[model samples]
Target chain A: MNALWILAVNEYLDGLRNRWVAAAIMLLGGTALALLLVGSAPTGTVGAGALEISVVSLTSLSVYLVPLIALLLSFDALVGEFERGTMLLLLTYPVARWQVVLGKFFGHMMILLTAVAVGYGAAALFTVLVSDSGTAGWQAYLTMMSSSLLLGAAFIALGYLISVLVRERSTAAGAAVVLWLIVVVLYDLALLGVLLADHAQQIGPGLFSALMLASPTDTYRILNLTAFDSVGQAAGIAGVAARSGFAVSLLLGLMTLWVVVPLATTMALFQRREL
Target chain B: MVNAAAVEKVIDVAGAVKRYGDKTVVRDVDLSVRAGEHMVLIGHNGAGKTTLMKLMLGLTRPSAGRVRVLGADPATAGAGRRRALGYLPESVAFHSAMKGREVLAFYARLKGIAPAECRSIFEQVGLDRAADRPVRTYSKGMRQRLGLAQAMLGKPQLLFLDEPTSGLDPSLRRHFYGLIDTLSRSGTTSLTSSHSLNEVEARADRIAIMKMGAIVACGTQAELSRQAGLPIVVRLGVRSGSGARVAESLAAMGKIHRRDEHRIDLFCLGASKMVVLRQIAALGEVVEDVDVMPPRLDDIYSHYMENVQPQ
Candidate 1:
């Protein structure tokens, strides 16, 4: 445990000094603020609450942005160390292989969490002050924040999986970008195409919801946009939400599963690797 | 005689074989290092020095045999037992963004040493002044010194250093070996691998010459020289313009090669050195100066490496 903490702390310090965490926070916070400003402008004319509109825009933004940030932050976590020759020095220490994996995962997760909290938290605070949002708006906004973190963790784990499976840092980086495209951009497009082509009533709502849970980004989308009636009505997913039977807990559980399974696989592969 | 039981074997490898895919990096080899002994491993590239070091350090498990460090299987040793060991790789790397002090403190914590102890270690490696500076600004030698400092943390019972002095200057290399000498005097067993035989030749208590994934020779300098059977070279400097005369007089004594107008070299076997010297003395005034060069580590290493290579 002590060795784990020491390794984690080292990684955290490395992240802090490298300034990527700060840059991520700035990027996320800046984009959230911009979306809040642009998104709330229509709330005054349309009579919709500012916080509700902001949550809708932010959910869409997170679906595109959070996974990219997570991948960029973690794609080179293991392979970079190997290329730099630090891993060879690190393994000679008394720490186990799993500890190194877990420690790095926790450290990168902390960075992602901090970025989400500070960036989205600032936007939420500003929206609450300027808009006449009640308790439900706050609850929905908080849910989006937490789900964004979970989505980021799932991708970060994916990045680590790539980091360990590939032998070169450049290859891992390439794989990470391709994975991001497949999961965040292409998966939803493919799902929509499938739904459109099922004109003969072949794929029903049950199969559709199950398919939505396959991608972590989709699970996060369902959790924030469909789990609550107010957010779902505002985000225009109410029709799908009424048809889907996935509970809020089940969606969150799926997201958590995404985080664990890939990370566990990374640990197993790293243990068997010669480095 | 000292009690044999009191003496400890820091590292033991018997019939160890390491293979990556179809190519074997380390063949069946047996080696052991006693406490406080400074053993140097000399080999050319692809000679399996690094693989042997990896096996002993538990970075990789041997494919065929067992390895023990500090009397325990290093591959399966617990953290408590592993804490007794330290290693400095051939190319040491650290987080470039971290300050020198922070880097040392991080490694110190990993080694279970207090962060405060990093100060003395920095001083020991002569990096105290640059301790507050980031590692990116450090020179190659300074980084190597920092690596040395990190390995010296917690006073490990066994140290495995590969090319430890590769980037160091002459004076720093001397100081580095001096530090190793001090550690060895206090009973720290050291197994260091190097390509430069001259640097470690005088300092090593025992030398192991590796060739083609196998140890071809292992012993002290004198023992290896005897095993290699390489002849010593005796150079005679005669009075100006008398080199050919001296060569002729010493022709029957040994194989004499005239170097120039004033110098001639005689190659004689180890056992016939004294007899040849007596013959050189018989020339009296003909010989101006005499110098005998015995076989050094490089000669013995080349002899073994050459003999071990397949024709």
Candidate 2:
């Protein structure tokens, strides 16, 4: 267990010290500050709502940026060590190979989680100051923000799985970027296209919900919508008052699946990679 | 100090063979280093020395045959068995992010070396002062020294050092081997694989030489030289203008070659070197030195590899 902690601490230090974390913080903080400044320009509830939308923006950013950060942090986890020849150094120790993998995985996750916590905290504080959404709004925003970080943890583990499953870092990086695009952007766009094409017909959003639940990004989207008082589903589910509760249930189930599945895949793939 | 304890088999290999698909890299090697004897294994490049080292460490498994270290097969030696062994692999690399002290402390923890005793292991390997500095800043020799530091933990009864002194400056090489000698004296048996010909001659209690994956030679340097019929050695030094004269005159006694300026070398053949020693005394001051002994490992190696290889 101490060995596992050592690996985790080492990996956590590596990510925290990484230049990417600095860049992510700079990028995420700049955007949040811009949103706050734009909303404070003397407007009413609609304008206030526009600023509150940063909560939604946080989800979107969490979806896209979290996976990108994850891939950056982990896609070269093993191969980088191997390429640099440090793997030979570690192998001489008595620790099992799995400990090394698990340690690095959790270590990187901790780094991303810290970033998400800081970014979401800033976004939430900005939401509170710029909007008149009150205590209920603040609770909703906090829940969504914390869960977004959990969602990031899941994606980072997924990047770790890709890293171990692939041998070449460039190949892993390319594949992970494509995977992030498919999960965060293209999948939603494709779902939107499917939803539009099905508008004249009647197939229920079952397939869409199931497919969206398959991507952690979509899972975060569902969680934010359900947790923050149906903000995301206002257009799609508000008029259908009777079905709103079911959407909430779908959100919880999807988030649960997102957290469980990727973590399981990462752990299992890590078990098999040599060094 | 390492406690030898009772006699035990530290490394035991049985019919180990490794194949790289169609090419067999190591073929049926059966060898062992017992608990208190210095064993040296020497072979040329591409002679399976590196592969053999890997197999012993469980970094690679043999396609056939068994390897047991400290009564446990390394391929399956739960972490406990590994904790008991210290190995210095050739071309050892270190984590750049870890300072030398951090790396040593980490390995010491893994090896179950008591924390109180860990600092001394670093001291023993002469890395105590630089332990806190990151390994990336270390040179090749420093890294090799760090490798030795890590392997010196636990003071295990057995050690496998693959060219442990390869990068050490000659003074440190002698110092390092002196440490090895002290370890063996205090009861740590070791097998050092090296290409530096004189190292085995100077230190190994028994030497094993490999040719094409087979143990072609094993024993002390003197025994092997005697078996190969290497002649007795004689070195003579002249002041000036007499080396060539001494060389020609010494040719009457046996095979003579000018080893260097002011030095005449003769191979004693069919007679004691005392006969040539008497004549060379008349020829010059014999100012340098003359010693009559069996051929050195350098002479025996060339005679064996160059002239005695084929039937």
Worst 10 residues of 1 chain A by lDDT: A41-50
Stretches off by above 4 angstroms in model 1 are: A44-50, A134-136, B1-7, B236-253, B258-264, B274-290
Q: What C-alpha lDDT does candidate 2 achieve relative to the native structure?
A: 0.70
DockQ of 1: 0.58
DockQ by candidate, in order: 0.58, 0.29
**lDDT score, residue B128, model 1?**
94
Q: Write candidate 2's Cα lDDT for A109-144 as tens digits.
A: 677766666766676666666556544456556666
| Candidate 1: tens digits of C-alpha lDDT, residues A17-111 | 88978998999999999888877655644334666667789999999899999999889999999999999998888888899998998888888
Query: All candidates' lDDT scores?
Result: 0.86, 0.70
Which residue pairs collide in model 2, if any? Answer: B101-B131
The sequence of per-residue lDDT tens digits that candidate 1 reaches over residues B1-311 is: 22353247777889999999999999988898898999999998789999999988878899998888777777777766667777899979998989899888888888889888889888888999999999999999999999999899999888999989986889999999988888888889999999898899789999998888898889999999998888899988899877777788788777888878888889878888898998889888979899999998888888998786521
Docking category of candidate 2: acceptable
Q: What is the Å distance of residue A68 in model 1 from its true position?
A: 1.1
